[model samples]
Target: MAPSSPPLPQFEEAKSTTSTVLWQLYHHRPRSPRAIALSVLTFFVLLYMLNTSSSQSEPNFWTKFPSQHPFPERPEDAQVALPQRNDITINDTLPHDLEKPNPQLHILLPAQRSSRGSCRTITSAMILGYPPPTLIGYGHEAHGTTDFEQMVGRMKRTLAYLEHSRTVKDRDIVLLVDSEDVFFQLPPQVLVTRFQNILRKNNKDLLRKYGVTTVNRPGPKTAPAVVQKYTQRVLFGASKKCHGAHATDPGCVSIPESSLPPDVYGWKTDIHPDGFLNRPRWLNPGTVIGQAADLRLIFKEALRIIEQRQKKNGDEEAFTQIYGRQEVVRELERRRTVSLFKEWGYKLLGISDATNISTINIRLETEHRYEYGIGVDFESELFFNQLLSADDVEWLKYSNVTKTSALQGSMGVPREHRLLLPTDVAALPNPFNYSLLALNQTTLPLWNKTLDKLPNPEDHTWNDIPLMTNAHSASVPVLAHVNGNTKLRNTWWEKMWFFPWARALLRRYVRASQGFDAAQSSLLGGADWWDMRGGRGGVWTDHESWVRFADVCQGQERDLFDDDLGPWGKENGDPDEPVYNEWGNLVYGKEPPQLPQPPQLNDINDHW
Candidate 1:
């Protein structure tokens, strides 16, 4: 048959093709089992490497895990009305049915007598329409011989006021500052809004850092997983230098890094001979803000540390130690919940450990004891601690949309300093304005024609500029703590926007009844913090007694008042006098005038 096919060309070609196929099949024996397995393993290894590298680059990846703890609740949310943008207008006369707002703001300035600087703090707060501060340790001289002793006295008195006072509720906001150093820059509205906003932002970061999130539960419900909850409720001013501790102590070395950019201080960052280039990571007791309840806890813990140590240590040391320990505990909890493989991944990625906190030893009680929700204003969003950071700030006006960019650039302001758009800045309403015509819809002017045109020629328009801003952090700090170069206090105080018309502004603030902006209050989760009674200038003492604002500020007129702007009282009033009331009453008698009791809330909407 082959010989017959050879005679046919088609048959011979088919035979040749079959032979070639058989030869290829024989030579190409199934790849060796070992080689195939090795190849597959290499492919998987490459894929995993790629996946891990990608995740490492993403900041949030491997940082999120479901939290096991419950979300904290605010009781004020139920009592305060949700703010609407147009719910209320700035009015000269408050409604008769107005009631005390929920979670009222309480300022605490502890001092023996109001100094020029302390008086400036009081005057600024008043001008900005803040509630009368409760003066802790006022009229008490000779606190202690040492600086530590003085700090302890202040903390003790502050804690006592928060713990025993009836007027200050647990939820009420309390701002405590160094009586002679700190000064308010922004209004209470901005302070409250920024505070809540900062807390929210910080808490979000804390949650991520702790690798905690919320996830779905068994059914339609959702719940936090087996993880710890980390949040920041109490914020303290941040400083570049650590006080009351040695360079290598946990207080100095164990604090978390500041959230500010690495180059916030330019080329000298962390390398300056004076330590001015370092980040603001240390806790500053000079200025702090928190709820009354949280404040009480932190103060109590600090005082306990001071008493237990029996050393010359102060509240600053105690606070620093506390913060260090809190971070350590948080890191321990974070690692405990995270997977071992993730830990290895983190090590490979060069992410530094939380802190060299193992050197710090403290009794780890319930999480609540260590976790006072203590956090620092690293960005100076709420408070600026001017220690080594004196040169980081400048005064620039953003209300002028056309000039803002040029001003920032010419002034050497960092790009981060212009975070707020010119339109946003220009559109900001003057919180101090309290007329029917002063609706929230009306934006502040770049020049303030009425104030700028005053007969007395001064370079500043109080309505035009905000106070000292930290260009490094892009923060318009609510208050400034002049902790460094004591002489700067006077110079910086003069730079304040309200320094020229403080007396007049203070009167305007007190004369208008305290009310809440629905939109702003809503930002604080419906907590009305502006609950001041109209027409008053009295400060509640740590002993629960009252003192006249005029009495405290009598000798401080030179620093707080602009005589050329006229007196704080009615037209043609004495320019040098301190007027405390609309009735022309110079001072009240032994018993202080009683604030009107809030109208009974027959219905929830009655006050509204």
Candidate 2:
């Protein structure tokens, strides 16, 4: 229409070029505003959803599972159970074969010796007189008996049970004696043999003077007046009387009711003293010369004492005047010293040299005089159990050493009442012999192999010496290797420089959970505010200053860099002036320098 455009470029040619250009524009053009906005909105929505879901999830996901699932509820309880018994098997007949044939066995329960009774004084004399295998006493009377009868009784029972279960012959019988109430623990056969030997060894004159035609029995006439004096002294002491003889000057020894300690007149102290004065002096009846007859002797002696006391007093109430059955039992307990009995048994058995064995006092109130045994290694606990069960004896089981009873509250029933044989001694792992050898011989070689592959050998220098030098060298790329392979990365330089440094920082964070100290230095990249000038490149400061400055700039990077470039970056006044050369050499040496440019308004106000 405007001169027909001269069909200027020929419509077809123009159209072809236009189509090619249009095709390029279609692929290369910037996206539309609406499309860009939609993409950004979608991304934001996805990010928000991810954050919300993560926050909503349970913190302890594993615990949320059903109880029927077999996952361990507690970390400590997950340890695998250890083997109960060892592979070594022992024959039961071995103990019998080792023992001599038909050796007579004897169980001796010494007469009860009470703190307040005649037996008590006798026991003290015997203990003071003899060496090993000395006489000890135990009785049935409460106040006149040993102090630790329950403990001694349990030990006797334990030994007897063991011997009987082992099918040991009567001749092989071991003498079991109580310390306070009885004197000797020798079996009848052993006692007879020993007595014969003694008689042979003693001179005729000595035998006539000391030996008796018949075993002399102590009675009222034999009882020394000194014993009564001592008894009165004890009574006075218990009553807190600092002066006077108790029986000779009764009023002098008697304290006013208000002055007496609480329960001074109770059966425990006063009544027992009175019983000692009233009861007829009798011979130690539990003293017997027979095998397997200790308990029987004790019972007989107790009955004899009770009967004698009743007859001597000639009153129907004579028995009540001294003590009831409970008091008799207590008297027996007072004289019984289980430790002494155990020591005597050990001396007699010839098994005292074993280093790992220890005989402890086990108090069993339910049983009569029988109480001590060896503590075995924990590894032998099951074996001990097997032996005991086969022997027809009950084992006392305790939850722990501190508890008084075997069973626990609401947990479950205990196994049984038995002595504990801890295998902890035998099963203990030897760290010096085993664990050290493994670490030095095996693990160290593996670690060395990995170190050999590092690209930079200088980095290994830190591994061989102090860590600080290594950390300094590692800060420079040229001096230290940053290998991609983790095994290679674990070289000495990496470990000493990075790992320890990182670990220290992690520890700080962990400790922060408890409490934190603000004065500690940062472990991240070095500081920027402290004017550190000797770091990796000439661009940064020295290690110490950089570390310090980095700590100051802990959360504010932009502010730190801005401050450095502003007032902190200047020489005297203006930053544009070059006071020194690029090599850090002063251009004017000692001379004062002149400013190269006028101070800008921004430099004066904005920098400040």
* Leading candidate by lDDT: 1
What stretches of model 1 exceed 4 Å from their correct place? 1-71, 74-101, 142-149, 212-228, 311-313, 351-353, 358-368, 399-427, 431-463, 513-529, 532-535, 562-608
lDDT of each: 0.65, 0.25
Predicted structure with the largest TM-score when compared to the true one: 1
For each candidate in turn, the TM-score is 0.71, 0.15
lDDT of 1: 0.65
Candidate 1 residues 1-608, lDDT tens each? 54543357787799899999999988887889999999999998866654442333333322232213232443223132235334445553434545444566778888877788788778877766576777788888673377767767777877888889877777777788888888887666567667787877777777677755454456666564454367777888899888745666666776788887677667778778888789888888888888777787788878998887766655677888777766766666655555455657677897745557666555555424566678888888888888888887877665555565665665455765673523323344553444443232212111233433322323333325655767667667878888888989888888887776565566554433333443243243332335432224657677867777767776556666746543223233433344344455543223456798866668557756
All models, RMSD in angstroms: 14.7, 50.1
Candidate 2's C-alpha runs over 4 A off are 1-100, 104-193, 196-289, 293-608
Candidate 1 positional error at 218, Å: 20
